[model samples]
Target: MRTGKPSKTAIKVSSSIVTLGTTSYGQQILPDGLVDASEKILLASGVVSEKGVRWIKSPRMVSVYRAFDWLLPGQFEALGERKAFFERQVRAGIAAGATQILVLGAGFDTLGWRLATEFPKVKFFEIDHPVTANVKAKAVSKLGRRGNLYLIAEELGKRKLPDVLATHGSWNRESRSVILAEGLLMYLPAQAVRELFGQCLAIAGAESRVVFSYIPAGPDGRLDAGRWTGLMLWLQKVAGEPWLWSIEPQNIRSFLEGIGWKIAPELEGGTGRHSTEYFAVATNQA
Candidate 1:
């Protein structure tokens, strides 16, 4: 990430979130009202342009997404599925009496914002890179204060989650929590990813759930990218956020167990909506 500027990939993902929220296909996966709220945040932060919003809502946007889907092959829809999965796990956690909610690498996601309003008593937190968090914080400020929502700025890979979160008075390590790490693990080094899971377990109370997404390696133990692999990798490289790690589906169970988490059984054959990417829900309990 560049100094004084957010991650280019973060900005791009935010734009995609807006596009998914605005289109008819997107509404099927994500709630319309939440998508609208996210769009407002991106617009205020200047991550998305007004003209782009107009285009996404127009009929012509169908052609654009169709082309992207053809080229990217389920990449666009995967994001929507990830968001929806996160929201479901969070909601279930909240209903089961979890109080502290944490979103890692939140980018411009509006889950914290929307849920904070609905469940004002719950403490909601989003930890992101300083550059991206700062932009989103300023945009959220314009919308009005959400007293229950806290945005913390820190480079996730550089600091230990327990140490950084300890500085915040509102963060409670002893409380039951829902920890979210979406579109984040692949960006971190392998060691960092292991440490992250350990840190979350350390910070969480009994029965706490951790929801995350990961890319799965192919039969040859390499990135299982689509036909546009070169283009996709090049785009990420240009954005300064190249992929760094992947876990085979077979290894997920042992991997999570090593970090003291038990993988949940809700996933379809233990894979997420996309063939290349997968979302896992795990609990601190054995």
Candidate 2:
């Protein structure tokens, strides 16, 4: 019952980290064309240094990632809905003539690489840990893909995210780009989540758009007290990321609206296999 900060080792054992090893079902769910293209990009970058490859191939990382993958597919199927939602958002941004993208807690995500390739006119900033960012950078470099892909080496719930984004360049508010925080909100403390969102809102312009995913609070408004509570508990015990917060669907909508964001409910019903809870995308209205 004593909840404390996770150890360094525990942090390293994240479910997203396991996706790097190519063992998780994420690869299967992702479009084959995208997967192959991303791999090629990483190989050509020389940025996919030996260290990057080794980290992805580590047995321990692979095992943990796979475990999380197995326990959460039903949940994942819901989360996976975000992929299409993201695609649509990107297209909307492009059509609207936006030119910049900010992806928070990017994990080993290939969205930046893919979007950059597809939308040559847009710039992408992928914020993640230094080690992970470096690996991704190398891969992008090797792929010889051309786009403004900035890798910010910093922790998501730490001081470095804001600093890295500011150092990169100011957001082109005139055109209104998109900021994505996919599958990331459920892992942080409520205060941290609010702080991060505050920072994002501050930096984002009225024309800017933001999209993210969150776990809905159970009927009792307690974390992990739902049907999937047992599974979540097991995942936390093994993967080491406890459920910190769970907002009601309506509450999330209200929270975003209060922050001057125009909520676009992509995932409804709930965060379950048949539900759209996998992910949702929204934009800053003001």
- Top candidate on TM-score is 1
Specify the highest-lDDT model's number.
1
lDDT of 1 by residue, 1-286 (tens): 4557876766666567667766667878885476678778888887778987786556666567767785568777777777777888898899989999999999888889989999999999999999899999999999876999999999987888998889988988999999998888988889999999999998998989998888877777776566766687777677778888788878889999988999987632355547457888888875
Off by over 4 Å in 2: 1-32, 38-73, 160-162, 170-175, 224-226, 266-278
Instruction: Tell me the whole-model lDDT of each prediction, alpha carbons only.
Output: 0.82, 0.60
lDDT of 2 by residue, 1-286 (tens): 1223223222232223333426455555554454455444444434354566456556665565447654554443333345545655666766776688888767556678777777776888878666656665676666665647777767776684556566666445344667888767766888888777777766665667777767667667766434567776676667555667568766777776766666765422233323314355567664
In model 1, the number of clashes is 0
TM-score of 1: 0.93
List the candidate 1 regions with Cα displacement exceeding 4 Å: 267-271
Evaluated against the true structure, the overall lDDT of model 1 is: 0.82
**Total clashing pairs for each candidate:** 0, 14
**What's the distance in Å from true for residue 45, model 1?**
1.2
Instruction: Quote each prediction's TM-score.
Output: 0.93, 0.71
